[model samples]
Target: MSERNYRAAIIGTGAIAHAHARALQDAAGRVSLVAVADVDAGRAGEFAAGYGRARAYGSAEELLRAEELDFVHLCTPPRLHAPLAVTCLEAGVTALVEKPPTLSLAEFDTLIEAERRTGAYVATVLQHRFGPGAVRLRRLQEAGELGRTLLATCATQWYRDEAYYAVPWRGTWESEGGGPTMGHGIHQFDLLLSVLGPWSEITAVAGRQARSVETEDVSMALVTFENGALAAVVNSVVSPRQTSELRFDCERGTVEVEHLYGYTDDDWTVTPAPGHEDVQALWVKDRSEESSGHASWLAAVLDALDQGQAPPVTTADARRTMEFIAALYASAFTGERVRSGQITADSPFAQRMDGTGARWRNA
Candidate 1:
C-alpha cells in the first residue's frame, strides 16, 4: 500500500517454498522477500540465505509480528492454509496460498469471510491458468473461434509410490484434503473450469482402490457446465505413466495440452477443422513466451498489488474449484448427483471429507 517494493514473506520452507522464493527472486525490482519461516529454524535460515535479504523465523507468528509484510505465501500443507491465511489477513497482509487452498469448502468460506473483514486479499496458486496457451485458449473460446464446446476431459494421472505416501499428511483427508482429486488433479481441473466457466452438475465415484490412504486414490466425474458442454474428469495416483492432460472438443476443432506438472506453448496443440489451419495462427499470435508456472502467476500477483486489486484465483474462482472438489467427493461417496453450492457450511462433507460420515457411509 506504499510506494516501495511490496514486502513479502514465505511461511513454510518446504518443497513448494523453493518455487515461491525463485518466483519472488525473479520479480526482483517489483517485490522483496523480507522473511522466511518454518517449524525448523535451520530450514528457514537456509531458505533465507538463498534469498540474501530475507530474515529467518521459527514460526509464522514471529514473522508476521516482526516484519511489515504486504503479503505472505502460505506454502504449508493443506490444513494450515486457512489458519495461516487468516492470520496474515488479520495482520493487514495479503496472502497467496498454494493449491487445494483449504481442507474443505467450510474452511474456504472462513477465508472468504476473513478477506471481507480485513481489507487484505487472498490469491491461490493456480499457475496453469496464467500460461499464454491458456490465455490464448480462453480468448479464442470467447471470440467464437473455438465455437461451441461439446465435450472435454481433465486428467491428472500421476504416480506416487509407497514411499511417497509414507509422509504422514500425503494420503490423509484431514492433512492433505483428498488424494489426487484435491492434491494432484486440482490444477488441470481448475484450468478446465476456467475455460468452461460455471459447472451445474457433477456425478462421480471415488475409491481407495490402490493407496493405503484414508481417502480416495482414484476418482472420476461427469461434469455439466453452464455453457452446455460436458466433461469427464479423472484423478488418479496409481497410474504408472504419469501425465496431466486437458482436451476440449469444440465445434470448430479440438484444443489440447499434454504435460506433467506445467505446460509451455510446446505442450499446447490445436487441431482445427480441415480448412482451419489459420486457427492455430490466430491462437499463437500475441502469446507470452513463458510457460505455466509460479513465476508467471507471481508476476500477475505483484502487478495486481500495483493496481490495488485482488489477484487472479481469488476466493470466488478458488471456491468454484474447491466446490468442485467437494462435489467430486460428495458425488463419489454418495450415490447421487451433486450440484454446485450443495456442500454448505452445515453439511458433513463441508466440515470434513472422510468417508466415515452420513452422506459418505450411506454410499
Candidate 2:
C-alpha cells in the first residue's frame, strides 16, 4: 500500500453523498474527507459539519478552485456528472461519480477523452459489481466453473411512487437520464453485464405505465451476450413488491441472488447440477464479507489509486454499461434490434438517452 493518505471531497451534499462520507470515514487512515460542495450553501455547511472536519463550499467550482483534493465524489445530478468530472479531471484529480454517470453516451466519451488528456481518471460508482457475492460469481464464471452460461434474467422491479418524483430531477430525460432503465435498473443490469461479459444485441420496449413523468417508468429487454447466452431484463418503478434479482443458469448449475438495493453473500445461492455437485464448494470457498455498496467499492478505488492504476468501474467498463442503456433506449424507440457499438458517436442515442426524442415525448 502506498504511504500517502489521500484527501478527498464530495461535490454534492445529497442523500448519496452521505454514503460517500461513510465510505471515506471507513477508510479513515487512508483517505480523508476534506470538503463538500453544494449549490445550497446552508445544506453544504450542514453536511460538512456532520462529516468531521470537511469544509463546505457553495459551488463545485469554488471547491475545485480552493481545495487540493486527490479525488472528488460527484453525487450530483445526472446532467452535472460529466461536466463536473471533466472539471475534476482537468484539475488533476480523479473523480468517482454516482450511477447514470452521465446523461448521454457522448458526455461519457468526453470524460474518456478528458482522462486521456489528463492522467487523472474517472470512476463510475456501480457499487453492485463490487459486492463479495458478485466478485465470487465473476471469479467462478471466469474460471469456467459456471460452465456454459445458457440463460439468465435480471430485474430491477422497485416502487417509486408519484411523491418520489416530486424531486424535480427524479424522472426527466434531460436531468435524470432515462427512467428506470438508466436510473434504477442500471445497477442490476450493470452487474449482469459485469458477470456475463459483452452484449451482442438488444431489443427492448419501454412505457410510461405509471407516474406522470417525462420518461418511461418501465422497460423490458431481450439481451444476447457475446457468449451466446440469452437473457431477459426488466426495469420498472411501478412494482408494488420491490426487489432486485438476477438468475444465471449454466451448464453446471444455477446461481441466483435476490435482494433490494445492496446484497451480501447470504443473498446468493448456488445450485450444482447432479453431476456437478463439487461446484458448491467452489462457491463457498474464500467468500468475502463485503456487501454491495459504496464502502466496498470505495475500498477498491483506493486500492487502485495506491497502485497508480485506473480505478474500478473505469470509464471504459462503464461505457459498456452506458452503451447498453443507450442501445436499449434506441431499440425501444426505433422498434429495431440494436447491436453493440451500433450507437456510434453520430447516433442521436449517443447525444442523449432519449435520442431523437422518446416516443412518449410526442404522445
Model 2, 114-144: lDDT tens digits are 9999999999999999999998888888898
Candidate 2 has what TM-score? Answer: 0.98
Q: Write the per-residue lDDT of candidate 1 for residues 35-67, one digit (tens) a residue.
A: 999999998999899888799999999999999
Poorly placed runs, candidate 2 (over 4 Å) = none
lDDT at 53 for candidate 1?
76
Strongest candidate by lDDT = 2
User: What lDDT does candidate 1 reach at residue 132?
Assistant: 86
Positional deviation of residue 6's Cα in model 1 after best superposition, in angstroms: 0.9
Cα-based lDDT for every prediction: 0.88, 0.93
